[model samples]
Target chain A: MSKAEIKSPLPGMFYRRPSPDSAPFKNDGDSVSAADVIGVVEVMKSFHEVTAGIDGKAIRFLVDDADAVMAGQALAEVEA
Target chain B: MVVRVLNPGLSTTVQDLGRPGYFHLGIPIGGAMDRLALRAANLIVGNDEGAAGLEAVFVGPQLEFTRDALIAVTGADMPIKLDGEEKPSWTALKVRAGQVLSFGFLQTGARIYIAIAGGIDVPLALGSRSTYPIGALGGFKGRAIAKDDELPVGNAAGGREGRSIPEALRRRPGMPAELRVLPGLYWHRVTEETHRNFFDDQWKVAPEADRMGYRFRGGRPLQFVERDQPFGAGSDPSNIVDSCYPYGSIQVPGGTEPIILHRDAVSGGGYFMVGTVVSADMDLIGQLQPNTPTRFVKVDMDGALKARADRAALLDRIRSVFA
Candidate 1:
């Protein structure tokens, strides 16, 4: 088994869900594949998708939802 | 020549120097938010200083060149890639037909400018090719670009590739920008404490900022001098009789948040303007990102003129680099 960390490409507010009223894109123990949108980083009022680059089972998020993230910050961990 | 938009990331629009002399007709001088970057992009590609180019916010668009072209990217530190290979910004580069250009995440600044040789060949409106999205006036169909849109490019005017801007001229992100302002037109209405605080405290740019204006928070709530409400004036303490809003006017709607109007702002409004951002620092406002700390510095008319002269000199220095 191997684990990989998802990183944010830009500095902004990280959101687990697509919107405030919607369910999160992925959760702990959920399966994801490369290019599966795991979250979004909202910056300059623009929303950019944060995609999972490796096929894996979601482990746990490293940062809380709606937290401010820096460029290249680790967002979540997944087990492959 | 033509370039096809593959992915219109965020908001991408074509703009030039902008149309002036039409505010009397309620037309805003909609153009590139950062004129300095626009000029840099054009100069790198051997185009006129006011040549039309694409302005991308945050993320940049992916485009496929249909013919050999020379291009330069400027402003923000958004990473550029040609067919997945990294490319340097602020430098002119040659692109072959069928080659795709894409952008990675923005590393610094909030906007990026892409200038191709001979500029983007869109029909001009009102003596300028700048886009006025509110009224759908100019640029490509008078709106932000969409995927699959094929933009016409003009014939190259002898632009050379590999020319780069010196590092000293580039704007570094997170550097606290000191913007010079000329106080006037209802500035006396605010309490002295609030006026002092405006220049003394650090203000963070609000997330709602855009081309129209850059709003600021984290500053002390400004206090207005008590006065009888004039007829037609709104009940808000910050309301004023309808008046013209000059470009870069800083208005406080409710005395809590201050919005500095930009190139795309309305010509007039009914808000109390505390100060006008000097023209020399207008480009700095375009680079401001959400949550960035900014400080306003008060300057007199003489100081403002001096700043403008200093900026012109800097631009000349850059122009002389390739001359």
Candidate 2:
């Protein structure tokens, strides 16, 4: 398998976990797959799920939670 | 197939359902002003619901088809002609290569949509074929149709022989008055008197109105409750916090008049959002021309949902006709 990178489809604030104080959906060294829901992109109180496109392990979280992200902005990198 | 533009009618451009899911990046959904009409026209000629077509305002350009192709027109009542022969609207017609298509003066409504069989071959931007004129992106080179410009027709084929619009469905849309609206997130920021005035008064559309937004005249000024005023009475107390604006959001700056934002509107605003005209009724708003008087009636959330549901059912019925 090859390393995979996850990206946000829309520009919005990224949330690592469901809400503040909640455990992050994935952290470094976590194993994941294409079906995993890595996080969310929230706009105007509406949240959209950001799913991983490839099966891999969470190697790096490129964007911090609640950070504003642009369209096609990179969110994380994973090693499959 | 080729089509020649004789005169680019009032602000003609290729548009579709629009590019959504990118509003957070400050991209406005600059699609067709009348989505239902766009879809209806496309369906008549067997085009996908999201296929790109021509969005004409008030009057339409004189187009001469260079191939025998199927096309349909809907929305406005702009008289249509092919090869100097009067053409019927809301129905598909096959035009020969040498025939010319033209539009007469519009008697009612401001915009009309012309959908060809296979859709237009405009390049897609941000995952859509809709035109976003302000950003200089999408559509035919991301600009309005110009004289002598030739557009390539899509190669998609028509579905069936011919179809007619239901008699009852053929509506001569009346001049819309104040648009009914539901309170938005910032509705409570204004004083009670101001809120009442908004519902009670009639607003005249400003001449400066465009696809971006419509500025209305003759409305009340907003007064914020001291507690509701996030920013205390600073030197510029009129300034409000910027809020995410969906299409049809009415913003009241200084509570004087209301500005109804439509397709091509800015992503966010810093005004008291008094209300949002329901989605179903949004198509009517697109037809309102400058100086038109409109009334705003308030409806509950339930009513809004019911209207949406009704619209969905109507569309579903129309779609089933092809099944």
Model 1 residue A21 distance off true place after TM-score fit, in angstroms: 5.9
Model 1 CA deviation exceeding 4 Å by range:
A7-11, A17-29, A33-37, A40-54, A70-73, B171-174
Clashing pairs in 1: none
TM per candidate:
0.93, 0.75
Candidate 1 chain B: worst-modelled 10 consecutive residues by lDDT: B169-178
- Tens-place lDDT per residue, model 2, B221-303, is 66776654455332334446666888898876666667788888888866657789998878777776555667888988998
The candidate maximizing lDDT is 1
Which candidate has the top score in TM-score? Answer: 1
Model 2 has a DockQ score of: 0.01
Per-prediction fnat: 0.34, 0.00
lDDT on C-alpha atoms for all candidate structures: 0.89, 0.77
In model 2, which regions exceed 4 Å deviation?
A1-80, B170-173, B222-238
